[model samples]
Target: MNYTLHQLHVFFKISQTQSITRAAEELHLTQPAVSIQLKNFQDQFEIPLTEVISRRIYLTDFGWEIARAAEKILTETHAINNRILAHKGLLYGRLTVSVVSTGKYVMPYFLSGFMRQHEGLELVMDVTNRQKVIASLAKNEVDFALVSILPQQLNVQQLDLMPNKLYLVGRRLDDSSLLSDDPGQLEKLPLIYRENGSGTRSIMETFITDHQLVVRKRLELTSNEAVKQALLAGLGYSVMPLIGIKNELLTNELQIIPIKGLPLQTSWMLIWHKDKQFSPVAQAYLSYLRANKEMIVQASFDWYQQF
Candidate 1:
């Protein structure tokens, strides 16, 4: 009948993670501590909030209802705190951003200075594939979507941040055949591709279809990091963002081939649905980004422009 807010918070995290161990790790608490709190929270109710089957925890229907309510309470509390801070001349609130997986490497640089200015603002970033990011945008779950490929169906406004160039790169092998200016030479290398629903994969597919290049699809990995690893292991070549592979290129671990239609050009964009109302924090970020985008790109991405 009576549950504490701490218990509500812990239970909400447990619901989100679906594993006591993981919830403990995220909450920075011990497994035993999480178990104890969960038990204590459950003791307040006669019915079960969570159940275990096959060693995995699943929330009960009642638990789902409670978790949803708890989320609202937590969100409202955060909003109140933000409003209080705003009265004190601080731009404070949670700024949730859903970014396509590879965008993780780039969004941070743009977000750094703006976040530094608003110390009280919290950041919640969902680094997932393009599908999930688009889904989040459709659901209005985030303040911004950092993406290279904008969704066609969504009515959104975009601010161009920096150029995103994907280059066909392979290991710095001594094979002269792998280095070619001819676009037809693309058929030679076994291509390491990102899985479907990835922006990189989409671009790679378009390039393939346009050139009528029959590529050797060696692997379809799930993430940029995975594709990079496959490349390092000499599995295959991939069209990788220069931003993600700067160190490898500098260390001579990878080399960009000189092809006619290469470095698939796109822009990193800050996108938000046209109809979504802006929170103060979101508004501040948009303003900061618009005012300082040129400067941020100059400071952080000037090296990329050489290619």
Candidate 2:
């Protein structure tokens, strides 16, 4: 009954990670420290909160219920802190955003200025696949979701930020004439791919199907990083976001293969459920984005537009 807020915080992290060691690493605490706090918290309750089976932690039904309550309590705590700050004409609160894996390259540009303006705010950016981003938005688990391909399944409002261009790229070829102009030539090179549910993968598949290109699917990777590595190793070519390969392109590590009607286009968007009630922090973020999105795009990605 005498559980401290700190105990709840520790337990919440443990529940999310499902590993005391990982929780400790993220919290910047020692393993023993996290274990001690968890034990202390569990001592206050008669029912077991976490049970270890085969050295793996599992939250019991009671533990799941407590975890849900802890999340609400933590949210309210953030609200209270922001409320106090607002009284003094200052901004303070937590902002959580979920973005597709490739959006890691883009969301920071949108967030940098807002973060500088509100130094007191706590922000969590979760980079995941498109499916998870959609799920988070549908479940109202996050304040915003950043994606290239719009999720039609969710009734959401969105702010279009910038154009996302996907280009067919491979390792720089020493001989320009080695690659042919024939449309059927691409079929000879293996095609690297992102996973099935990825926005980029969807776009790539659509392009291939529309063109009736018979490609050798060499590898299927779950992330952009892996696909890029595969490209660098001369394993295969992939249609990747130009933003991600800017440095590689500039350094001549990767070269775009100009296919007819190439560089598939989509706009990057910041989306939220239509009925989402924004927290004060979320409101501040949206306001900043609306006011400065154009400026941020121009400043941070001027080269992108030029290219």
Candidate 3:
């Protein structure tokens, strides 16, 4: 069966996004236009390709098989284009990176600079939580991930980007003000924990368990921003990344409660699949990260400390 590259691109995109509307948004096509293209591809085949239930789209078994083939074809096409661009002495390609939300504060700045430096490259940045970032990397859905927490799977190359320290923060006048710099004080403060499965939550759990301290409060939240807001509102004390609340610290909306014996170290990492081949643009982006690693870490420390 003969199908145009555009139809294959639509098929791949829809399969990747799992929703025609999202695929349309990504490809800058109207919903009807995307549906029509998908219909054309389905018409070329012997079996049904797509179905909708509860307004959600799903590919049939045959459709998935075709989508996988289309993926291989697209990958080869990209490789050929990269080879031609290399021959022309031009570095041109696409790189999609997934990152944890906390890293969103500084990671995008570096990525923006890299894109500016490599003018011909196209970049897509997906900022989500740490767990989502890991899933993206594991699925080979993104070129790389910037994460503060290590993944459960150990197959990816995780280069240390910077040290992320956890701080116990609270409203300036909250009951947690009674918390002294002593680590034992952690047992007395009402604790606001990150949502389960978070890298930060994992670290906190390990620290508390190792110390044999019973957590005084167990309110759980997901985002760093949510944790900070809860603390600022005097709901309870929270262990949060220093970068997440720099502005709050600067404004004195919240203050760090010095807690001793807490594990203060988790490194932000640039993670990618060990077996995945890097295009020239991807290599240059990684090189840019390593080249500025120390400077970036130091500046982040300085900026957070100013609060």
lDDT by residue (tens digit), candidate 2, 134-212: 9999998999999998888989999999999998899865666647755565687789999999999999999888878
- What overall lDDT, based on C-alpha atoms, would model 1 receive against the true structure? 0.89
TM-score of 2: 0.81
What TM-score, over all chains together, does every model reach? 0.84, 0.81, 0.71
Give the better candidate number (1 or 2) by lDDT. Answer: 2
- The whole-model lDDT of each prediction reads 0.89, 0.90, 0.81
Q: Distance from true position, residue 14, model 2, in Å?
A: 2.6
Local error of candidate 1 at 142, Å?
1.7
Which segments of model 1 are wrong by more than 4 Å? 1-8, 22-53, 58-80
Clashing pairs in 2: none
- Total backbone clashes of candidate 2, pairs 3 or more residues apart or in separate chains: 0
**lDDT for 86 (candidate 3):** 74
Per-candidate RMSD vs. true structure? 3.4, 3.9, 5.2
What are the per-model numbers of colliding residue pairs?
0, 0, 0
Give the C-alpha lDDT of model 3: 0.81
Model 1, C-alpha of 96: deviation from truth (Å): 1.8
Angstrom error of the Cα, residue 126, model 2: value is 1.6
